[model samples]
Target: MNYKPTLIFGRISIAISLLLIVSLLFIDCNSDRLADIKETEEILRKADASIQNSITQKNIDSLMSFYAEDACLLPTAEPKVEGKAAIKREWQHIFEIPDFNNKSTLTKIEISKDGSMAYTMGTYLATMQGEDGSPVEEPGKWVTVWEKQSDGHWLIVVDTYNTDIPPPDHK
Candidate 1:
């Protein structure tokens, strides 16, 4: 047996094995990251569904439960509403409207790599009694920022929405 040939083959085999190990490690890291993203997405989806349910049921407490203590709400043509108490008050006012109905469909949700923060953009359709007690429908878009708390629950930290169509006076 030629010693040179044997040594060269042994070195090549070691290099190939190292490369495979590194590749496997990289793939495992990526797999974990993907799983985290999927989990975050699912959490956001469930939260969105719960929010819609609360709105449909006109449950102000349930709706406020989805928000963080320091959350902010930026409503259309209105000043920013901040904190849980303020947000609760805002929802209270809306829920008091006669025959108020609202629904939201999430279009996109993006989460950070660390799984600590996320943002969701969506569309909303709402119906409520107009001044004459007639049903009025308003279609709009919204964006919400979510943050993960120490309890491992995600809550909305910032929310904003605006109507797709301008008010009649604008036309």
Candidate 2:
């Protein structure tokens, strides 16, 4: 007759063990999701800064560092430039534009919940140094798409832009 107490205790232990296993599984799943979210945000930040830095410095070579080998750029006014070489030429032409001396800023960087992709869309204000070296500011907007590489690096998959104000020649 003391067997009743032993049987009840064994059942309670088994129930508690099952609950612990489910709780652990849930926790592990949540942690993995959180890590993915963090990684996605980090990639977004890297892409945002890389593009702004490239434009501000007008460094075509440095700018290409962020691009994937097969990346492409679709300019607002011109045909799409596919591949790193074409993109480099595009940047070179941009740097040579009249009063091309300028700076830009980026904001509103966002990433998908799954963290596989991201984009940075923002306004840019650039100032051209006059022949007198005085600053002239021009503002525009840009959007860039980013992909996370298998090596854990983020690269620009697509780059595109549009100016808030048309080029002075157009006006």
Candidate 3:
């Protein structure tokens, strides 16, 4: 046997083996990442469901619980409301309105690679009684930023929403 040819073939085999191992490790890491993303997405979906349920029940306390202590609420036609207390007050005012009804449909949700943060974009339909007892509906879009807490729970850290329908009397 020619030692030169045997040595070259041995090196080639080792290189191929190393490449295969690396490829397998890369694939396994990616699979784990995908699983993490899916899990995060499910958690966010459940959270959204809780929010909807709270709104349906008009439970301001439960709804506010979804927000972080330092969360911010950017409402349309109003200044930004910062902190849990302010957000709770804002929701309380909305809940106090007679015939108030709101529904949110999540259009998209994205999670960070590290699973430390996420965001959801959705459309909202809100109905309330006007001053003359007339039913009014406002269609809008909203984006909420969520952060993973130390307790492994996700909470809304920032929320911003605006109406899609333009205001009346626009020239």
Candidate 4:
């Protein structure tokens, strides 16, 4: 047996194994960060879907449930509404409007690595039908800031929306 050559190859193999182990440890340490980011993204997606469904179903309470206590909203052609109660009132007012049919299309969703914060921007299409069944279409965009609470609940911290194009056939 060539003892010298065999011993040298064994030492090199052990060194490589040690390096690989250290590399895996580093990767494992950051795995939680990636998981946090993924969780945050999922939460935002669920909130978006909930809001869209709420709008479609005309469920005002469900629509506003994802808002934080101190959240703020900048609605089109209106003053900013702050706090959860005010936000709820705003939704109620919209829900009370006759012939309001709205749907959202999520165009983008981005989240932070810590999973503590995120923002989503998307387009909204609303059709308000007249008593005679004539539909008036409105297209707009919205951006929402979401924050993960201590209790693992995600809520909108800030919400803003604006109309990029006026309603069809408007004066």
User: Top model by lDDT, which number?
Assistant: 3
- Stretches of candidate 2 above 4 Å error? 1-20, 129-137, 166-171
Candidate 1 has what TM-score?
0.91
Best by TM-score: 3
Clash count for each candidate, listed in order shown? 0, 0, 0, 0
TM-score of each: 0.91, 0.71, 0.95, 0.79
Clashing residue pairs in candidate 3, if any?
A: none
List model 1 lDDT by residue over 22-89, tens digit each: 99999999999999999899999999999999999988889889999999999998999999999999
TM-score pick, better of 1 and 4:
1
Question: Residue by residue across 1-171, what tens digits does model 4's lDDT show?
Answer: 789999999999999999999999999878977777776777778879988898889887888788899999999999999999999999888787678988888888888766678899999988887667787777899999988799988889999988877546956
Candidate 4 runs further than 4 Å off: 1-19, 130-134, 166-171
| lDDT (10s digit) by residue, model 2, range 59-112 | 787888899989989887798999998889988987876577545566677777
lDDT of 1 at 27: 100
**Residues 10-61, model 3: lDDT tens digits:** 9999999999999999999999999999999999999998998999899888
Backbone clashes in model 2, listed as residue pairs? none
In model 3, state the lDDT of residue 42: 94
Query: lDDT of all predictions, in order shown?
Result: 0.93, 0.80, 0.94, 0.86
Candidate 3, overall lDDT? 0.94
CA error at residue 87 for candidate 3, angstroms: 0.3
Compared with the true structure, the alpha-carbon lDDT of candidate 1 equals 0.93
